[model samples]
Target: MLIKVNDRVEIIAGEYRSRPAKGADKVVQGKVLKVIPSTGKVVVEGVNKMYKHVKPSQRNPQGGRLIREAPIQMSNVMYVCNACGQRSRLGVKQLDSGVKVRFCKKCNADQGEIAPARKPAS
Candidate 1:
């Protein structure tokens, strides 16, 4: 999956896209905390929050509800380009130095290097 941890993303589809209140951003955007490539799901910060009920245990003297982010389908999110500050698709390209990097498809901005430059063969 192109989406990686720490990458900022915006929800393109699903109920999370709905604004929580007036004057809020139209889309839900957050940093990717985790990615499950096998299941095609990603856990984004501040999105898809779910409450987990916990009983009193040794770990917690007082039990309470904990809010956590739930995984959402990878297809529902679009990468937000760090350079252009816009949501766009990501593409991988190899530079002349042989470094593979992720780039934004909309503004053609380089996000960051995915792999180190390869040494030329003797």
Candidate 2:
């Protein structure tokens, strides 16, 4: 997953693309909340919103519509490089110390490393 958690991304496609509203930039930027590589989807902050009708519960006395972010296809987003501040492609590079890291293809700057998954405990 090149676009991991906390990485800033720009919505390039889908319904969330830039639209005239009030005073807003033409390009929408947000951080990645979750990445579902299995489904090729990503939950970006403040994008692809959906409303969930909630029932009354102990936590809430009144039930109402809950707005939340919905997952968008990974192909619909592009990685925004923190280094160059531009939307760019991601690429892998290996260091002489035998460490592999993700880098911005446009600026050729190091982004970060993907941590290995932890093993399940017995």
Clashes of each: 0, 0
Instruction: Summarize candidate 1's per-residue lDDT along 26-70 as a digit string, tens digits.
Output: 447899999998899999988877677999889987999877777
TM-score of 2: 0.82
**Cα-lDDT of candidate 1:** 0.86
Candidate 2 residue lDDT tens string, 1-122: 78899999998888667552234334478999999989999998878766778998889769898877779899999999999999999998776656678999999999997644344468
Looking at model 1, report the run of 10 residues with the lowest lDDT sum. Answer: 18-27
Instruction: Quote the lDDT for 27 in model 1.
Output: 42
Cα misplacement distance, residue 25 of candidate 1 (Å): 10
What lDDT would each prediction earn against the true structure? 0.86, 0.83
TM-score on alpha carbons, each prediction: 0.81, 0.82
Off by over 4 Å in 2: 18-27, 115-122
lDDT score for residue 15 of model 1? 72
Q: State how far residue 69 of model 1 sits from its true place (Å).
A: 0.5
